[model samples]
Target chain A: MTAKPKLAVWKFSSCDGCQLSLLDCEDELLAVAGAVEIAYFLEASRAVTSGPYDLSLVEGSITTPHDAERIRKVRRQSRTLITIGACATAGGIQALKNFANVQSFIRSVYPHPEFIDTLATSTAIKDHVPVDFELRGCPISKHQLLELVSAVLNLRKPVIPTASQCLECKRAGTVCVMVASGTPCLGPVTQAGCGNLCPAHDRGCYGCFGPAEAPNTASLAQHLAVLGQSRRDIELAFRSFNANAEAFRREGNAHERE
Target chain B: MASKTPAPADRAGVIARAALDELVALLAGRGYRVIGPQLRDGAIVYDDLARADQLPAGWIDQQEGGSYRLVRGPDAALFGHVVGPHSWKRFLYPPAQKLWQAERSAGGFTVTTAAEPEPPLAFLGVRACELHAIAIQDRVFGVESGDFTDSGYAARRQAALLVAVNCGRAAGTCFCVSMQTGPKVTEDLAYDLVLTELLDDRRHDFLVTAGTARGAELLAGLPQRPASAADLVEAEAASARAAVQSRAMVPGVADLLRQNLEHRHWDAVAERCLGCANCTMVCPTCFCSTVEDVTDLSGDHAERWRKWDSCYTLEFSYIHGGGVRRETAARYRQWITHKLSSWHDQFGSSGCTGCGRCITWCPVGIDITAEARAIRDAEGS
Candidate 1:
């Protein structure tokens, strides 16, 4: 008898969109279930299978001390751990906490700051544990999720693209919005996987797939300035979903002085 | 199973009317919904077409960086344009698709999950570049991610027939040749049937080639002439001219970009980039999206929906109360790095397809290809 590949889905400080991406595979959900043993998925059911699981999918960022410790346990229990979504891979949106005082944010959001138990900074899963693969996106793409799971199960490398959204736009036969419409877009710098939604709907890219293989963001920024975008606007664009990402972080810092 | 097997080097043109009429009948006969470009509200849109009359006949478009204008061609021939604003995407990953619907019943709660429906289709006047776009997206949706699975996307992709039209004229912004994806449908493997339009003194000739059993089956029902060598030569020459005319500015930007990550040039562009996601919406392959679950009037029922999201929005990066990318500079950096660099680490292909939509749609008209060149030039300087 062959052993079914064990699958586990974990969460942290995130919008749960990436984890939900797994569930969003409605058509393939049943097929996926048939392919693997559902060891643990708290969002789906109360039936939690005990670990030392085959594959563990961790979502969200490390925000609390307990969460930091818990991830270590997860790391020890799982043979292979893959972080999904922007939060888990690059401290997510919560990595914004890395810039500001967490206490102040807690005080502003919650009436009693003392009631909250959190670390000063929200960090990525990679900061604390070794990750086999890091899937990038504010909310990870469902198709990418399926591929990631399949690749891990097969012990093969996932075939995700490493090009910019601009390449995708070109392939789609779309007239250059920046050239044809003079619309400010991040397609040149953004990673692919979102299926070029914004451009199809008559909008520019917002860098949801994170940065591309070799992003010339500064050149894009300068071009945007020539087109009339203010420094503030350029600065804001750099501080998005994968803000803590080193390249993006450095670019944002340069704008602060300006 | 196919009647006429053209060699891999086959090239030809068919009569326009015969091709359209045959496609319409074949689609209707096969339980497929026919959709093609139609003149609607002053722009060419993908809509349901009942007959050949429904297509944009004798209409050509003049497209430049930041502008689009429909022009009358020399002849009243339909399918004269290279591409319209709409692609095959509207039918696949629909703008608004219901992810899951939840309704409360007596016992506890009844949730209804709808699967992606496969709607067979017959798409007419699909250009070579457009085919390349669909093929690239095939990797993203069909192979790379495989999430948001639409039996509809797969069905339409497989079951639906493509009547690829070779571009005889190149728009100023058209760079399919530079990207090496088009002008001529070199890789005929992608399409079931390929068409090249040849213009003579009186009318046009469409050289048709069938690559798959399905295409041959469909072609058998149509009135197609055996393509003569002259017909094939004329068609090939027309497409070649367009390919040569449409050259991308930076041919090796992808590799050059990979070499200069921290060249201190991004700061120059960040000054003016608004970080608004306008370029992404018009792009065909920017597939980054976010999902949201909401409750109706009563909190008892909840529904989940996926909406197109941008990395430019602050809320997109919201963690706890603040955004991770608090500054636009970092956000910009992250976007370019992932597209050209890290994407290689994830998917074996480049994330971009070299579409210049970002340049045209940018309100300030920032050219991405130009930026890559500038950065490269700066490195050399």
Candidate 2:
């Protein structure tokens, strides 16, 4: 019998919600355990037997000097590294510091500002190390994570779609929040995932899944203005969870307080 | 079972407001899954109807570019709302369908085509524009028009009944008057049954017309009175009122767009176009699709499925090297031009029915009629 492939789950500066998505697999987690050896998942197993993992599921952004250094070692140890969630893929909400003064933020929020140790800007894993694949969403969707794991095990390209959220909304029969209600929605510029939760519930998308494939953010920003959103409001919307994602960051900067 | 005395084509009659329920029961009893519009989550959406009461009898939809709202009508009139985001194509062509399923056997893989007959569908309250949209799809999918027929689409489409309604009211986005597609169901359009709701202070009834033999067969079973001269006049007036709606397309947009291929107006439109695929997804006649092949974890079972694809996406134009229409400008140009111009050369008719779904459902409210006019009235191309 062939040896089970080694799988490792790693975290750098994330909320660990993405790792929980893997555990949230439940029955699928059992199937995954049977397929691969859980080599060094600190969240699930204490037993660490790992030199080179066949696959690595990474969560969180590189928010510290240590994270930047540590990610390279992870990339070296892993055959294929898949970054999960918005933080690992887009720098998450913490990347909001990229636009403003991080030092001033530290001084205001922390009493001992000198003791704080963090990078000036929280950056995605791809910024430091090459990523084989990326799973989008604030906390990665469980079904997509399973598809990624299955695709990796089967030696095929993952079937995660890069289509805009508008496609998903249309497929799900959810009315377009922006079109039907004149509410400013990011579905047109955002990637499809999260299962149409916001739009189906009559709320506009919060862009939890980051920018879509070839997103026309400039066009979307102009329409947002027409929808009665101020420049600051449009900026804040783009600057939310995916503040550092290139397409989003560029549009967000375009509408900055100036 | 009711006697099958097929009434002559275009035979008009009046069905009372209360007899609408009987019609639903009759269709249901005839083993057709009757789908009709009803208020859902503050918008009129089509769904399975157990009773005619489920129809949004007194509700009306106010639709403009980037805005839609549902409110109660001044009077109780069934089929008051215009088309919402849900097009009848969703039921006919379907968003996703399994083409084939493969199973791994000990000897070899056994494959079964996914053409299992679907339940017969009866669509109620189909707008006049929608009837035209369905006929357009008929040309796209029917064996008589296309070289290769989509068996799956053919099966569902053939085994369905289209109950259309002449528009008594039109949304601000509607331009059917210019397209010559609707506000009235013409004799050429293939609809089983068509209804014209009559709502005055004294009368609450529908002027019904059967366009097909089966429609006549179904209508003969239901309780209705012969259409009086006054009832016919009222029905004609109702449709005329809707046809006078202000939003309209230019007389020769197809030729205008062909002449102004390099017009900078496309770039202007692209500046506001989101390229989100919402317009195509909601469009009744946009029939592009992409397929996916997936297997289970065991690798024993595999299935190939097709889902609706849009020209606005980069992947839709993807080739061996890269996407041809990488810029949103190029993609938008391809979509609108092909919809209004190239489609006529390919299908002998315009792809758009001027349903105004593309306008009202656009995130930016990009009106095709206005864009066509801009291209036509350009200072210099």
Candidate 3:
């Protein structure tokens, strides 16, 4: 019998919700453990193993110089590197710093600003090294994580849709909260993966999954304007989860305050 | 299971305004979960109907791009407005469904296919456009195709009892007249039962017509009177007004869209498109899906599931290396071309039923009819 493939999990700058999602896979964690040897996961296991790992699941955005160097080393050791959640795929919510002065932020937050070692911009893993796959979500769905691992082991292509969240809402039979109630929703331009949780609760989408394939953010922004949403509101909507993502970044930039 | 009873001759008649409660009771008595349009969360949506009082009796909805509002009508007329955001597809083709499950034992893996649950459903207030949408899906999922049959969809569709409502008024976004699917219920596309709501100064009643044997049997149980020529004329007028009220028309749009694949309008539309897939989701006939595998942490149990997907996403066309439709313009082109043009090649008809849900529900208010017209008119110029 062949030895199991080694799996490694890494973190950078994030809330750790995406990694937590993996641990939250209450039923499927054991099956995943059986399929692959957990070589290095600081969040889950204390027993660590050094790489050349077969697969590395990277979470969080690269915010500091040390993280940028660490990601390169991780890529060198791993045969297939997959980015999980919005942070690793797009710069995530921390990417809101991409629009502001990092130095000023550090000074305001910490008493010793000189001690803070950081980069001006938070960026995705793909910005530094090549990624085999990128799973898009604020807190990545546990089911998708299982599919990714299963596909890798089976030597087949993973099937993760790049469709908008609107399809989920439609299929779930949730009424259009934006159209029906004049709520400003980002679902039209956001990717599907969160199972349409917000719309089901009668709330508009916060765009946690980031920009779907080629989002028509301009049109949605204009529609929001017609719905009585201020320019600031439209900008904030695009700047939420995947703020540094190209499509959302461009749309948010368009509505930036003078 | 409810017995399929045959009906006596002569089932066409008028149901009294007060006897609407009896219709609800009759459907419930047959063991069907009665579903109809009710005002909820500020919009008319399909939900479980316990009694006739649950219907949107004195309400009418105004629909347009980026707008929907419920207003009190002149009288308590059920089924006064056209279609809403929710459709019968929700019941027939659910968003997410489990296909099978597997358990890893010491010996090996044990796989078990999910059993199909057949729950009897009676759909009230189904519009002609919605009926056409259901028929379109039937062609895709039904056994007659012999290609790939969705057993879940087939079972749910077969178990459903359709009660159609002839549109008395059309929303501003409606264009079923051009699609030739609605504004009027035709005999060939037979529903189990059809109700044409008639509200006038003199009386409020429904001119009911049974299109199938099942409908005739159901109608035989309710109180009614023979439809007079005046009543038939009144019903015809209502449908005519709806047809005339339709502003957006796409008479030969399929050929126009097919020929203009490289039109610059795609780029212009793409610029405004969020690639959010609101159009595809709201569209009653758009039926793309993706499959997912989920396993429990124990390494012992796993399940395969299918959920709704859209072409607007890059991953829908993704292979091993990358996606075929990487750009937003390409995705938008694929969606519109598939719905209007290529759907005819795959299925024998256009995928769109002209319910205008896509137009009304779109966050961007991208009018499909306007986009089609722009492409056609540009070629003319």
User: How many residue pairs clash in each candidate at the backbone level?
Assistant: 135, 0, 14
- Residue lDDT tens for model 2, A1-258: 988999999998889999999899998778888888999999998999966999999999999998999999999999999999999999999898899899899999999998999999999999999999999999889988887787788787677788899998998788777876777899999999799889999999999999998888998888888889999999999999999999999999999986
lDDT by residue for model 1 over B1-381, one digit each (tens)? 122355453433254565667678777878878888877534466778888788887887776555566779887656676565566776656644567888888888888877755557777777776776776667666642457555445655666666677778777667666666677765543667777777767666577877666776676777666777888788778887777554375755556767776667787666656565555655565666666555532335666766555675555676897888766566666666565556556655555554555554554555666667778789854
Worst 10 residues of 1 chain A by lDDT: A167-176
TM-score top scorer: 2
Better of 2 and 3 by TM-score: 2
- DockQ list for all candidates: 0.06, 0.67, 0.46
Off by over 4 Å in 2: B1-10
In the order shown, the candidates' Cα RMSDs to the true structure are 13.3, 2.3, 3.7
DockQ metric, candidate 2: 0.67
* Superposed model 3: Cα runs more than 4 Å off: A1-7, A29-39, A49-55, A76-80, A150-156, B1-11, B99-112, B142-155, B200-203, B291-306, B317-327, B341-347
The TM-scores that each candidate's chain B achieves against the reference are 0.87, 0.95, 0.95
Tens digit of per-residue lDDT, candidate 3, span A1-258: 898999999998988998998889888778788878999999999999898999999999999999999999999999999999999999988899999998889999999988999999999999999999999888898878877787787676675666678877877778888888888888888887788989999999998888875677888888889889899988998998898999999999999998
Candidate 2 clashing pairs?
A: none
TM-score, each model?
Answer: 0.58, 0.96, 0.88
Which 10 consecutive residues of model 1 chain B have the lowest summed lDDT? B1-10
